[model samples]
Target: MTQPLLPDVRRPANGGPKAAARNRAALIVAAREIYAAQGLDAPLSAIARRAGVGQGVLYRHFPDRDALATAVLEENVRQIEQAAAAEDMSFADILGVLTWHLKESAAFLGLLHMRGSVDHSEALAHALALSDRVERALRERLPDGHRLGAANDLMLAVAMVSGAAGGPEREARERRAMAAWRLLGVEVGTVRPFDA
Candidate 1:
């Protein structure tokens, strides 16, 4: 009896191009959670596990830690851009979003320090654009006589919020960010003059 040989059937790899977008989204979400919980140096394997994907899928989406961090930051910037685009959202509102992200994601602060790296250039550009947009909104909202040094003051306010985000406790971080915003004459939920 001659037995016919059956053709070998192989399953497609986990992260085929069809799945690349989905896999990448999953990886980014996982990275956000893992990084927020364990900081930027958290194991890549942990991210893969959290994403329910394999290491190969993670590598395919993010070539390295910096690449993943950049993606995470880009996502953050995208969020800020959305807030900036809202007609009713004030500069203070956008700053609140930025501070919330910084407080929740340790990687955001870590990657902000890596602005010198080429991998983060896109995120940096987007951030700078958002900064310009927010600055414009701030300028528009400022008292007519207080427009002087608006740009410098906005940058200082951002720096203060970022610096305050390094604290270990969430409540403390929020308090510090609020104080910094107040020092810059911007309130968390409202924008007001320094003396007002």
Candidate 2:
């Protein structure tokens, strides 16, 4: 007899709606880890294996890589929104959260640059809206002479960090991000540490 694709221990016998939800959640967590360690181009099969689900289950949940990527980005946005909601989180703190996400997730920078795609647009919109709020807060905190040159300067700063975070080496990436922060006139000491 042929062996089942998923071990009996991994999948409940009923395999009902709850199982589907569990499989989807597992796939997202697995993809996030795999992508962070191996970049966005990591094979879908690896994600399936890591999630302990069959490839068909993965395809059912995410028809394509962009779909999966959008889901991951949405989760990241949710975390950022949560962090932003903290009463004491300063504008610099928000930037730190954004920078941390970009540095930690290989898929993040690539997906953020995919501006025209409808699949990822909603998550991107939420992230940009969060950035807008941060920019407003920053404006309030800065003196007239230190104000940003344009409405999108915060976005530019984020792009710089995202670009720097994609460097070949981790230490180099951190150094480059710091340099970009300094060039943008953001005080590195004011921003929260990127670890975690």
Q: Largest TM-score belongs to which candidate? A: 1
lDDT of each prediction vs. the true structure?
0.68, 0.68
Model 1 lDDT per residue over 34-149, tens place: 88778889999999999999999899888999889878877766666666666767655766777777766676666444434466466577655544554564455544555234
TM-score of each predicted structure versus truth = 0.69, 0.66
Structural RMSD, model 2: 6.0
**Local lDDT at 195 for model 2:** 29
How far is each candidate from the true structure, as Cα RMSD in Å?
6.9, 6.0
> How far is 98's C-alpha from truth in model 1 (Å)?
0.9
How many clashes in each candidate? 0, 0
